[model samples]
Target: MNPSHSHPLRIGVFDSGFGGLTVLRALLRELPQAEFLYFGDTARLPYGAKSRETIARYAVSAAEFLVRQGAEYLVIACNTASALALDDLRAALDIPVLGVVETGANAAQAHSHSGDVLVIATAATVESHAYATACAERNLRAVEKACPLLVPLVEEGWIDHPVTREVLSIYFTELMHQSKAAALAPDTLLLGCTHYPLLREPIEQAIPAQIRVIDSAEVTAAQVAAAVHAPQAGTPAAPRFFATDSPAKFQRLGSRFLGQPIEHVELIDLEALEAL
Candidate 1:
């Protein structure tokens, strides 16, 4: 059943860091009336290197925190959490949970007539083989590339720099070469990392014209809107932001991802939850 929101619906969005703001940015467009509570587990971030158990524990705590904040639906905006702990999250949370990986694979199936797609994500997300597994479930073949440098570059706010473009070029060149070597004809290039949406322009410039670029944030927002059919507009409510680390730093860098200034960022301690 599709999830429809009532007026003033509370939607919770969680990420290991500020990258998930892109997802929240898209969701705000799709569900303008719904109130948003975004949590950035910045203190325990770089979740890519954590064990599955640890990742699940951190994600579950974040989910529970959102639920406590009256969130009726949860969006796991972090690719690492979504890749490694989606099933655990879904099983543990009562609210419906949506992840970038599944939404991305669904998009690949819809966009690729050749049933082949290429994914560029962080090392941890690619290492999980979650995208590949999700695509195969839809009868689509996926080639996953671990672009570790892209995240830091994005966080550094060097999105349009020549160096960023060159890095994108190098990654895409190798990805294309690898795709051809595997005898796969891919027509879709799916951005598996949330931060990737920020570098979309440069990344697009580096890819072949024939390949369609799928923004996971965009697709996830569309899917949420489709599932939860509510009024197109609701009362204008300022989004509440939470960070486990420095609120000032989060607001400083998060403004870049959200394409606007972020204000009223609240710092909250999540140490107790981490032990859970």
Candidate 2:
């Protein structure tokens, strides 16, 4: 579908929790004038722990809700949902749906000359090997490592803490060793989690200076903006925020992710939609 710049675009960003706010933050910066509808399925958080079928069902419901709200474009901002339910979402929705895994893989493909890339994400995403498959399709070799502790550390508001850096140091040390043992000279590191963007500063500092770090949220936003055309100047509309549960937490943590105040958030009942 051709995204025309003739009018304001209603873009939907969906995630299982507040982490995906980083993607919306990037989108807001890239297309500040466009309308945004963000939904966090906090009622059923940690989609990584769910089965493939359940994940597909939950994601499709979120996509349907956004489409009904007049979302012309859909951005699956959750790495777990993107890894497991992207195809289901595209089949279920009639609009253009973009996922982070593919975008991150594309970025790696473009940045790598050695055809070897490194990915660090949650345990569930790493187990899915979605990044590996996406990289393979682009003729890139990828080594995926699960930094299971980083998510909690980020959520705990320890972005620049010494403990966070220590954990990251260990993860990077192990990742580099693993990649070398695999006989892959990886020159690019892909942050496969939306929450990882918040830790980009520390991550970049921890990784080798020569390795190019790719943030999935930033890359996805760049791709969406490129596809949707340039931003326009007008009285830009305030983004609409929704969460299946915990509007307060969404607003609180979301403000941190967006790097600005999140004025209000609406609580949604996606349970009814899931049963539909």
Candidate 3:
């Protein structure tokens, strides 16, 4: 589809939880002229640990919900859901569906000349080898690490707190140790989880200065911009926010990710997805 002809594109972004706000924030910044619909499945969050079948079901439901809400394009911001359910979602939805893993992997490959890349995400994302597959397709090496505790830490707003630092030290130590043992100390590390970006400061402090950290949020935003139709020259587009639950909490936490206060957030009933 010619996105440039589709003015005021209605873009949809979904995550297992609030972490997807990271990607939404980036998109809003990159494409302020585009309209957006954000869906956070806080009712069924932490999809990282779920089974593949379960993740697929959730993804399909989320995509259907967004489509019903009039989304012209869809962005699956959850790494776990993207890794396990993207194909299913594409088959089930008519709109163009994009995922963070592929964008992140491509960014990592482009930034890492050494062919050494580290991916830190949830257990499901790591186990799925999504990053490994993306890198292998380009004949590059990638190390996958799962920092399960980091998501909760970020959600709790402990980005630069002492506890966050302590936990990060432990995770990074293991990641670095694994990389060194494999003789693949990556020059770039992919923050595969949206929540990871919230902890970027602490993560940077824990890792070596020589290593570069890549946030998929920007890459995903660029992809969304490329896929959506550009806005008309004189038209103004406003971003919209939606959540399955806790609009107030989403708005409060969203400000941190969005870098500004969200004017309003609307709550939607995800149950309507069953009909879609």
* Best candidate (score: lDDT): 2
1-276: candidate 2 lDDT, tens digit per residue: 344656578899999998999999999888988889999999999998888899999999989999999899999999999999999999988899999999999899888989999999998899999999999999999999999998889889999999999999999999999998999988999999988988999999999888999998988999998887534766677899989998998888788888999999989999876677
Residues 1-276, candidate 1: write the lDDT tens digits.
223555577789999999999999999888887789999999989899998999999999888888988888889999999999999999988888999999999889988999999999988999999999999999999899999999899878798899998898899999999899989999999999989998888988899889999999999999887776555555767889999998899999999888789978878788866556
Off by over 4 Å in 3: 3-7, 272-276
Q: lDDT (CA) for every model shown?
A: 0.89, 0.91, 0.84
Runs in model 2 deviating more than 4 A are: 1-7, 230-233
> Which scores higher on lDDT, 1 or 2?
2
RMSD of each: 1.8, 1.5, 2.0
Give every collision pair in model 1.
none
